[model samples]
Target chain A: MFQPSMQNIYRYFIISLLITVAVNFSAAQNKTAGSDKSSEVKWWNGFLVKMDVVSPVVTGFSDSEHFGMEGSVQFNLKRKIFPVYEIGFGGADKLSSNAIRFNTNGVFQRIGVDFGLLKQSNDKELINNMLTGGVRLGWSNFSYDLTNLSLSDDYWGGSQTLNFEGRSTTKTWYEIVVGIQVQVYKNLYMGWNIRNRHFFKEDTSGNIVPWYIPGYGKSGSSNTGFNYTIGYHF
Target chain B: MKRESGNNDYFNFKNLFNILKNFLHNNFIKSTVFIWITAVFFFSTSCIVSDEVCRKEKNSRLKVGFYTAILNSSTGNYTLSTLSIDSLTVNGVDSLGNIMDSVLYNNSKNLSSIKLPLNKFSNESKFIIRFNDSIQDTLTVFHTNYDQYLSFECGIIRNHLIDTVLITNHFVDSVKIQEHNVSTIDAEHLQIFHN
Candidate 1:
């Protein structure tokens, strides 16, 4: 079993926090040098439509083992809090070294909120940039097929082949996400985020569990993922 | 005053835009993106190759240990201790009293314990044990077997629960069931005691 160490989690969080502080400090310096327009507080700001650009490249390199593509809509509120809804399709076709084959494909969803860590500034350029940290709850319900499973009785002189088709299961996990987004052009942004995902429950003994989860990467106690995204702010 | 300030703010915004455009064109951002993409590719590849392999034991067998009862002189009590047999031969037998072709132990010498495989298709297993090629005993074991799924790589294994054991008291004195459940775990399941 591959277990993510607590020390690594702590180190990731510390690095994210330091990056947030550094970006915030730089934004503050720029704000002091720019014009001082009266801060306008709007309860509802427009949302951004974002698409992940990294998944396809990864899938292509994975040699048909893993495939995933996802998009998200994030609503900006008072330029501080962001509520997000993400949806995606993911699948896996894996052949074990022992010749057992597993196949599955399904849709997954995630709902979360992000808090902007930088201080609000009136500069038009600075207002569009954000350093955020968030939490997400993700879920997927899917079915899988496993074949070429063979069991032999060496002493009894017999062998049996077993195939399990359409084994259904539901999985849920939580993520700690941290990212920085910067405006590249008018209403266009480019960003990258790192996620630390943890599963709520694991498959019990004697049950056939999935080798790969839809939104969650490989099925394990925990995993780490990275996403590069391009977005258009409306 | 408001109009002049508005014009000045517009000029500052244009200057900031130009600075950002130059920043994006710099080599730093370009290299960062390239490095990130490379890292992501390697990370995904590493995940794909790191598949779990089945390394656990898969064979299920019954372990029998030889023991003897000895009188403790000072305590005036009898204690059971391990016994090593001088010569032993064991073979499987059918219900019709015909010996099977497989020989579990072929005249083995100086063994304190021996492991034997039970029948997966039948409810009972019979074995003939010959001591020094002279004194012989027949041991019959009644067991119920079930399949247990271990993992994808390991597949399934048959586990047995011993219901009863019958042994003819020839060279063997008595038998006791130490552990009834038998799976891949290597442990003593039965103890055969001799005088």
Candidate 2:
């Protein structure tokens, strides 16, 4: 019989389940405070709240094999340039080799700018429509748990091979996310974003070939797996 | 009574050892085949159950009756498996590098439609499929079988980049038989969890 690792699988299942429940509950509870904006402020100066859910096209082992949550709030400092803070989770599916499930995923918190496309109108004929684009740079702690993965060769292929059935943690991960949003209603809007996550630094052949870092169209490029969420302005 | 019981235990151990030896020598691939059969059977079972959704007979081997690319262009129609000392054609290699000849392949078929056979494999063993060095040495494909799944693992090893693997099935059209990176995975990590 094969060596069964049922215990570890069960533990992983529980962890994933808990995270799913927590995120869903958090979104529901913050609906009022983060859903729609009240009509108390002027068009030029207002706060916008946004929340989104992400389901990946490629996942499992290579990435966190589950749908994750991410949301943010931005209090418009001005009409042209608005500074905002955001936080969320991300996972990678592409790999350089099969030996390692080259996964780099974690939570991120960033502060960036949101540029509005159209000028705020004084007329109320249409519910205020606007176009927005933004970029954010944040820090993330990437952790790879190898406890459930194993690599063996022969009868003597012992634990010296750095089997993945062990868990590992790697912090100091940085990612950049840029996206565009279109506001159709007063505060309700539709938006899409692409996030790029790199290992921050690469250490290959002692020359540091950017193993921990990623480039354009290079490794760890999150193409188009973002979500569409409804936002309300306050 | 104790002596008799000890003798019985001794014989039981001897019998188990003999059975194991036989399994290793004659049925060398017994474990491997069992795992492979189970994986094939499982995916086949799922397709069978999902018949009401999309009606199709339970195909033991996915028919590649129609293939688009025949000329790999770079590698002259033939390559060698560096790890296993076998000649692997463009389609896929087996335990021995002989171009996988299938019962479905028709000699009279044109090159355009000359589809390779199904990559029949099991979980009892893992296979490494090496490509001709002419194209690029950055890619390596792996085959690993399990009780309920047959995974094809592929990865690119770049000198100045982060490495990654894609573990999935042969059918590139559907999202069902998905693949993942297996390097960092151990025996403990495989699971089917709920949302």
lDDT of 2 by residue, A1-234 (tens): 745443343345345434433443444356547755433444467877888633332223224433245677877754545677777666443333235343444565666765543333344642233334445555545444321123332221222222232233433334333344556665676555544344455423211111221112122322112445567788
lDDT of the candidates, in the order given: 0.81, 0.37
Best by DockQ: 1
The TM-score values for the models, in the order shown, are 0.78, 0.35
The residue-level lDDT of candidate 2 at A91 comes to 49
Q: Judge the docking of candidate 2 as incorrect, acceptable, medium or high.
A: incorrect
The window of 10 residues in a row where model 1 chain B has the poorest summed lDDT is: B20-29
- lDDT string for model 1 (A1-234, tens) is 856655365466657556555555556567657855424668798999999987887899889798999999999998878999989999999888778888999999999998776556566756777657888999999998888877776655667777889998889999878776878999898888877788888778766778888999888777778888999999
What's the C-alpha lDDT at position A153 in model 2? Answer: 24
Total clashes, candidate 1? 0
Mark the regions of model 1 whose C-alpha exceeds 4 Å error after superposition: A1-41, A118-123, B1-49, B94-98
Q: How many angstroms is residue B126 displaced in model 2 relative to the true structure, after the best TM-score fit?
A: 28
